[model samples]
Target: MTRPRLLPVPLAPLPNELIGSYLNRLADANRLPIRRIDALIATGRHHSRDKDDLTGWTLSSIERLAALTGRNSPALIHALPSLAALAQPNPLPTPPASLTPTAWKTKVCQLCAASRGVHGLAVQRTYPHQRICLQHQRWLGGRQLPISPRFHELIRANIRHRRLLRGHRDPLQPSALHDEARTMTSRWFSNNNGPLELQRTWDDRLQMLNPDTESDPHDDRNLIEMVTYPETVVLTTLLSKPHNPVHHDFLAEVIRSFGLDPRSLPALHRHTTLPSSMRNPDTPSHPSRHRPGSKSTA
Candidate 1:
């Protein structure tokens, strides 16, 4: 029986690393063809991800590679971000069978791909709901790509958005708030008198924020920019809160800021109550006249 050769570098896998990336790195560092590395761990000649044998890897192959790399199987597997979800009690749903790897690039975080020591693109950090890279405080718009000119305003709001996720432990809030933010911005831009000029101004400002987008003016304006805006997120957060006597006027005030009459928003009235209905001895001068949590008339 032939003894398996040990890796020259014996690099330990990083957290959230992809199995494919690890194999590629091992092959690159050892000056070996990637296909040879693939053959060493492959259970058969089956190719996944279209002729990428690494994608069709099996557990026995992982164990074999772990030994070759001088790392434990469990540790190696734990470091695989793509497989991490499978370990959960409720694993993520499998992707559609017809979808190809090329169709899935936008799902991953761009900044993580640009990280040092990464061999190539890693698929482990792909969470489509995640529009912001909290680690880099940048936007992840494309495959392993980060948008430029990181907007301090949007970054600050994204921190609060993450806070809401952590503070409440609600997985749904991020997407819900994100959706509402886009809706608010779309509504604002939809019925405006100077839509073209306003859109041009917004596009120009957005270009300043992400200079790469300026090179391609024909590209559709990224909605994530609107969704991550501080004002948009602030309103979305406030709207997500439970309706109370304290919030009715506050919500109405925010609605009015978009140049629309508060009275036109019946849904807002339904979700919030008038302050007058629950006013105490410490109540302010008027119900619809003050912002929430404030002790003054509007």
Candidate 2:
């Protein structure tokens, strides 16, 4: 049997009129975490500067909420602001406590229909303010999608058409974060380089082949890539083998980048003419050698 059709619940930033119309909805399906909702308002104020819609919404929602509760929503919200309201201590609370980075990510993804993706989840510094995820960053049509493009655009455009045009003019609020991320994405950054790390994997394979002394690091990488090497062809063959189940997708790319066969890692692991203490640490160290900046061999 087919599964029952689930109705799509409309996301919020719902207007005042619709909110009143859906007042019973909030009362019945009070799935809204009041603390979280309040925290969201506080976050808006912190990030949006003078342009805070949620605070206005909160002021109104609280008023209406309080009238329903036979108390005051504004007073209650003010008297006991959510953790997001407390600006100094913690940037943002993680799962169960407030909002998990994952939950925030999933929430943004859902809101945007995941056109790109929700970034900023990985950016630890700006807990509340971070880039869109790799998924949401819109590179194609040439628009840096803002956090609340749909939500804020409607408001900003209505408020000032000259300022907020649709994906037309300048970036909504220019941010320097991506510049920093791009500048940082080079060489042996743990996240960037896979082959450099293959030092261990290559060593393991060579050890299994001969079970001999630790192969020179340079020699090892070289052997792995060497045209003269049989093992060099082995992994490549695994990908092309008709009988093999998995494709060597990455291996193909590696071969192309490193060439059909490359230098042996033996030279890589070889010690320099000068002692370790004198070497420039910024330079990549060979196996059994320390990078220069570290506690020198002195």
Best by the lDDT measure:
1
- lDDT, residue 117, model 2: 36
Taking the tens digit of each residue's C-alpha lDDT, what string does model 1 give over 1-298?
2435677877766555456666666776788777777677655543222122244555566667776799876787677655444335586675433221121223234445556565444444333235667787555554223434444656677777667656655445544555555555554444332224334555665566546743653243454344336655666566556555454555555565545554555544333333222344554434444455655433
- Over 90-197, each residue of candidate 2 has an lDDT whose tens digit, in order, gives 454432311122111112233343332322211111111222333443211112332233233223222222222223232221112112212222111223233443
Give the TM-scores of the predictions, in the order they appear.
Answer: 0.56, 0.20
- Which residue pairs in candidate 1 collide? 110-144, 110-145
- Which ranges of candidate 1 are over 4 A from the true structure? 1-4, 45-57, 85-123, 128-136, 143-150, 172-201, 210-298
Q: Residue 91 lDDT in model 1?
A: 66
Query: Global lDDT of each model?
Result: 0.53, 0.29
| Deviation from native of the Cα of residue 251 in model 1, angstroms | 9.9
